[model samples]
Target: MDLIHRRSNSSSTGRSNTYDQLRSSPYADVIYDTTSGGEYLMKLQIGTPPVEFEALIDTGSSVIWTQCLPCLNCYDQRNPIFDPSKSSTYQDLRCNNKADHSCVYDLVYGDQSYSIGSFATETVTIKSTSGQSYVMPETIIGCSHNSSMLGRSFSGMVGLNLGRSSLVSQMGKHMQGAISYCFSPEGTSKIHFGSNAIVSGEGTVSTTMFMKKENHVFYYLNLDRLDAVSVEETRIETLGTPFHAVDGNIIIDSGTTFTYLPASYYSLVREAVEKVVTAERVTYQDDDSLCYKTDTMDIFPVITMHFSGGADLVLGKNNTYMDYGEGAICLIIICGPAAPNFGEAIFGNIAQNNFLVGYDLSSRLVSFKPTDCGVTQDIPIDDNSISAASLFQFNIKFVLFVFVLSLIRL
Candidate 1:
């Protein structure tokens, strides 16, 4: 489960958009979204009057930005663009303004997608799972004037990372530096912030997070190895090599669709999985998927991802295989082409289903507990109507097991 990947935080101009989060009152909420299997979305209400904006919750990217008014060739969006003129609380940051505004930010993605905008601060609100409206004022955000590829599908993106500009990092002392999310099999998921984000129980497995100075925004994990188990077991070790180390070679991102592994290592994993399954391997001319025509996935082996600190993620048939329609089921794990100077694995959201994954930045630990995410888990509210001591609870658990991780950067 040891992961290794190169950092892609630089822009075309060689300038890094290092946005610092403004210290403010922190509050937790559960944002709900029903997205395609590719990515998770969040319903957020920003500004003073609180206009609704649907954002793609991305852990890989930092800086929560949205399209602003006076567009300079903006994308085709379905939602109404955010107009700072309408909000009295909105303030545009100027490069020369020393009072509060610091500097303008320019962002560029690894895929060459870019956004240029001025730094701004405004009030952001979220509807908590407790049915209470919580607001965080003076929140730092990017009011983009020029953005690429971010059109009507989403108004903007909410950054949830360890970076200074990330939503979690900006929460500061208001939140206990913890965040968790539970994704259902039906593609409905909810994100929890603050103290309630902690995952505890017999099934919860905790692992130490590895952080590197160069890549501070992304959350890294110590992936030990991967195991393919059917009648016989096939093992692929990811650590103890110079390529894999404590600095963290693997990234767990919620926005990515499939788990990516390096080509060479993935070949070994695919061969092992193919040997254990009796279904015929089918290849499409236009698609890059390892698929088979099987009525059920039980014929395939269960994959276990073993990580450092004894954290094991046991992936069942539902978590490992996906239906591609027309009686074809494809494996969710993908083998990516080898990149020079980078050999890291990416554990995408597809592989994280049916589990309550919690990230505690203060303790530098990531905890995972298997649960029926299809069932809703509500947070306890401190209200007189409901006694805090006698709050409702559920009995869900996880099996501590591990699987192999493919080392792929992109």
Candidate 2:
């Protein structure tokens, strides 16, 4: 799948600072401004005649949903709401003969945004880079009738997580439980599934991927230590507390914006950063994030995250810091909970920019390889493929979503 960045209408060429760009942008929202909430969007065609629509690509979520016609309550969207009556292939998934046997789903996000709808199946079509259209019949989807707080740029969301109802799971043997995506800092990117998703080349590092019985949606990886040029290597267990390293510690999530570490470990990392950075210190009043007033991001030190099995991910300045407008830049890594009750630690997408990340669920391994994501790459299709079982082309659009700790199904 090929991905492209959706550009804002506002002119950003002559802006002296990020602050000016943020202020001039029309899509700026209260949550984190326009730039911070950016996410990748993909196009999907549903039903017999095919109603094409753009959807946000979320790795944290599982269900694929789009607002439907006769919406009792819904947020404004760029595309027309999907009308099931017009599609010949659309069919509601009825669990039983009961009057209320409609398979309904209620998805609530961390920011209190919600989507309520009936589960259904439809013929979905996605075009590959080779101009080949891959069709999947009877694909599970959520036809949302009520929704709130969704971005106006996209008509729906395409979830790429490891859930039973997800597109990957529904594809079953066709996808072979494999998926991979490469996110560029700007311009176009690509994602692969099944045999094409394999990441085995030079400079590629593989780490063990484990899942919790309670939550299978997230992809968890183990962190051995962290290293900076000037500071000593900091290990997770040495933080004056009992840390669980065997059960898989941090989550590598594409939906999240910032990386999160335990408070105590985060403090150590912050202190190490403070020692290396020579720029004038500043404070961001909005989130109190670690900020520095600097003209260039080059002053920031590179961070090396050592994961289990010799996977050392080297994070550069662009991966570790975010422009907080003005002359200030803030670290994208934030503190989560502390000690005994340590909450979920997340490895966000900012640090994943320019990397070809692959998840092979069958092998129970996740691999990473640094690459120039901005360049266009051909979608590698299997030559022996007889039918269009699983293939999707996605245009990457940056949209942000605040994840809730729990996904509530009502």
Candidate 3:
């Protein structure tokens, strides 16, 4: 199998420094700011009676888990915690189970947040665009206990990575290995699977996805250049050097709110942006964001990201700039700590709004189609080739659950 490997330094914790908590605080009541596009959640049903949960759709990490009953130190969530005892189809996985590996798993997040729980498999269900419900039994899941801060609006999280146990991979065979999501910064979004996941036709552009064999959880893309240029063809240089040949230099993260660039690249981009904006730039001592006093964004120049495979993404003034409120506007791009080997550039969800992003695992390619996601019509699912028997047949009484150790405590 072709896998996309994730490279992490052998730091004492084996996690990235970007998530290190600079301030000391209690983990239970941590609140994350969402004004900058923090996360997106989707609805799903699991187990016998089919309990519904609003799960955070995360592409950066692999591990599908939810807070369950008998919670020991779980966070206060908007939705009721899932109770396994109520689900007739729920079953626990034992360490000695033959068909299954170990029933226990430990997880730790980049933020030093952790969860411990049991890993089990159960029936998973999702609604189609037609409002019809589809069920896949014997699906892998984690019923977390002693969980900490998670997105307050989220009941749990759905893993959409390349790992074998991820929701995408678990549904790949039946869904033709297709998945797509269209995010709206102001509201919620829908996640499509199976035949409904295809994003083709006009306004669609394709790009090659780089995958390594070792770690396949993160999506890597080749970013050629990020530049701001005048219509006159005059090259405007950013902070650092012009450009470097960096292959698979960045990861597209839907879970994160802000886009992060290396310090040098960020300085260059910010300088170029400041030159054209007529609004007065100001900095807030309480926050590190660079803000301006203006309601008009059209006066700003267009920023274009040239990607591999000749796909150029042109950012609109509105997409690149955001309203910081109180008559203040701020640039969404942030300067991240530099990483050796260009290991830290992240294209976050803020920059991906109003676009239909699709991942075709079979073809090993990712596609971006420009559309007004807030009003885009749901694509019809074509399940003609799937046998009817397979749709309703329940495989071996599958059951598992785990406490997620690494989750976004929003």
Candidate 1: C-alpha lDDT:
0.69
Clashes of 1: 25
Model 3, span 1-410: residue lDDT tens: 32211222345545453222111110101122263135677778888989877777778767788888989778877779989999888888777765665587677654445667888778887764333355668888998887765435567777777778888777646565677888776554567765556678887888777765544567887665443222213343332443343446567777766677767667766777777777787775466676887776666667766667877777666666777777778877777663222346777777887888888877877888988877735445333323334433422212111223224332
Predicted structure 2: clash tally:
11
Candidate 2 stretches with Cα past 4 Å from truth are 1-36, 96-99, 128-131, 150-152, 225-239, 337-342, 381-410
Best by lDDT: 2
Model 3: weakest 10-residue lDDT segment is 21-30
lDDT of 1 by residue, 1-410 (tens): 32211112334323232220111222332333433335567778889798988777777777999989988967866589999999988987666655555667888764456778888989888755334465768899999889875323677778898888888887775576788887665535568777667778989999888777887678888666432222236676654443245556678887665777777667767887888888887764457777887767777787877777778778867777887777788877877553211445778787887888888887888889998877765555433233322332211111111112222321
| Tens digits of per-residue lDDT for model 2, 341-407 | 1367888877888888988988889999998877777655435332332323111121111123233
Higher-lDDT candidate of 2 and 3: 2
TM-score of each: 0.78, 0.79, 0.75
How close to the true structure is residue 406 of candidate 1, measured as C-alpha lDDT?
25
Best by TM-score: 2
Off by over 4 Å in 3: 1-38, 96-102, 111-113, 129-132, 187-189, 225-246, 338-343, 381-410
